[model samples]
Target: MSTDFTQEQESFATAVAAFCAREAGTREQRDALAEHGQHTHNQGLYDKMAELGWLGATIPEEYGGADGSVVDMCILLEQAAKGMAPIGGIGPTLITGAAYEKFGTASQKGAVLGGIVAGKSYSISMSEPEAGSDVGNLSCKAEKTEGGWLINGQKTWCSNAHFADRILLVARTGRSVAGGVTRQERGEGKHEGLTMFDVPADIDGLNIVGIGTMGGKEVNDLYFSDCLLPEDSVVGVEGQGWAQLMTGLNIERLILAAMMLGTAQRAFDDTLEFITQRKQFGRPVGTFQALRHRVADLATEIECGRLLVYHVARLVDENPTKLFPREASMAKLKLTETAKKVALEGMQMMGGYGYATEFDMEKHVRTTLVSSIYGGTNEIQRDIIGKTYGL
Candidate 1:
């Protein structure tokens, strides 16, 4: 991972890690920052990151961002996760922020991108009850009407929507459009007729209900009932949402991969620290051949994951417009799976202590277990990779 980073990136990583350690180094601090287990995002800590200008690591300088590359973002994300920062909002925020950055009108960019740098979070809603991996099957509809559009549909698994300033809502508009300034963007298929909307989080007729899960209130079900949106709510070319969304996948996958890579490293680090201290059979348990072999194997897997994550990230920075269906999917698949393995193995090694909330290993286990489940599940990632090879 360090091989792909420049000196400035390294310094940036150090600063972010140091800041995270200072702000959220202990469980007590984390509990306070996360609002006593109500949610994982710590707004105070997030605001501090914004003040330090880290949240805009990949945004353009004209918009109050550093204009950093994808690799730079990976560095920021990995260090934050490795330091165990509790800001859950940044992942989704950055994803949606990129959409606006690439396609939003001047006003939209000024509102959303500028808000992002000012510590405001954002979200995107692409999944419905029946359309998780099959995003093209989404039934969420935004129909044209007088003076604007009326959206009426339900979107589930809309992460961070409960606290977002705005949401990038993708809904089905129609198929085989006749004419518009961007009409040619309407490709024929299930992927066609989709449109992107900038839905304000507090807009009337939109309801955000939290869904309790193993990860707490990180996601919500969004109900849009005749949600009236201005004609300008449309983002990018009308009916080109799937193509627009696909443009960001390389960075999206890289971002998730880097974060999970950090989690894997942290899990391994925590396990090693525990085993080195907790003596069994008159010596540190980590000294035993059985545990030592397992640690070695997990360590190797994490390193491999880290390398792949950064390698793919560099590819994105080099080819900003190209689709990396195979490589990006591979990175997401490798790091998420490896991160899960590391946490589970760490749990097994620490025995009862790993299962106890008093230890961070249990938290690692919870987070890593779901890394493979979100951001395009590992199963879907495998399918994408296989399809890339014409399978």
Candidate 2:
């Protein structure tokens, strides 16, 4: 099958590329801004993007969004990654907003979707110290109360929590696993016990503690102690958070893949520029046969990564209900691995300059490493793919 972007999509991609070149590209500027622990996109850039309707690319126009396709969003994300833009804060927001659009109540959509479209940040809080990959084993408890629910637990590795206005939180409310529930009773038994809640950042008992990450992005450890949310806070239905989370994870993986591909492309571009200028043995290093072959291999792998990410995006847009566990896993696995390889190769090609803080390759390496670990590790992704074949 051939992969070609529509004219409109191509135009949008061009616009994003120009925006990144002007606003976010360059290691010194990005590093300086990220040091503040706030979003790297300043108010000026944020407002510009919001005005251009880029912030709400995946949101429906009815809710003040751009009413764009997921492919369009991927395009923007890829460009941002190529520019080395710090879009981590916005990435989860798009995925969570779509989740709310897909499964949240009317009020939930009205409250959450509008804020996100307005350029306010949001994050998803699912990982805990005890439960990173094994989300089913999460111990965060949400006991039903007279008004709403009392949440008491800790969540770690919550990205953008420091600046997020809200979080899409998952907590346990029932006691059943994969195959125990009957067909009629399955919705309740399989998903009935878990619940999703929209929790505001400033809620009285919610505490956010910042954690330093390798890539200079700030993640947080969240503590919820008797934090109370109204009954209306429940996203789709009580005890269905697991199912809802599963429903949106495919999109999440695709988004992560897009971001990795973008970063990898940037690394490749930087490496090309470096080798074209940097001389070794009295000639440009890029002219050497060994390095030229390596560049060719990296280019081919990146094409594979792009195809995998775009294929998953198309599949999701085409069939929102069909499970794409294997495809999503493959995309995440391939893109992150490719990102890591590209960064490493870029570093090797650049030699000492690549390791120096003056060059972006060092930061790119750190960032790519974190991407592999986030959204589930590459090992876990491989395991999921393996399990799909009934291994």
Q: Could you say which candidate leads in lDDT?
A: 1
TM-score of each: 0.95, 0.93
lDDT against the true structure, per candidate, is 0.89, 0.83
| lDDT tens readout by residue for model 2, 120-202 | 87889988897888776677889888989899999999888888888999887667545765432453443346788899989
Global Cα RMSD, each model: 3.3, 3.6
**lDDT tens readout by residue for model 1, 1-391:** 3466778988998998899889888888888887656687988889999999989888889889989888888888998999889889989999999899899999999999889888999999999998899898888999999999999999999999998999999999986545653332453477888999999999999999999987787999999999999999999988899999999898788889989988888899999999999998899999999999999899888888888878888888888888899999999999999999999999999999999988889888889888988889999999999898899
Residue 66's lDDT within candidate 2 is 75
Indicate the worst ten consecutive residues by lDDT in candidate 1.
179-188
Q: Compared to the true structure, candidate 2 yields what TM-score? A: 0.93
lDDT over C-alpha atoms for residue 9 of model 2 = 88
- What candidate 1 gets wrong by more than 4 Å, as runs, is 176-188
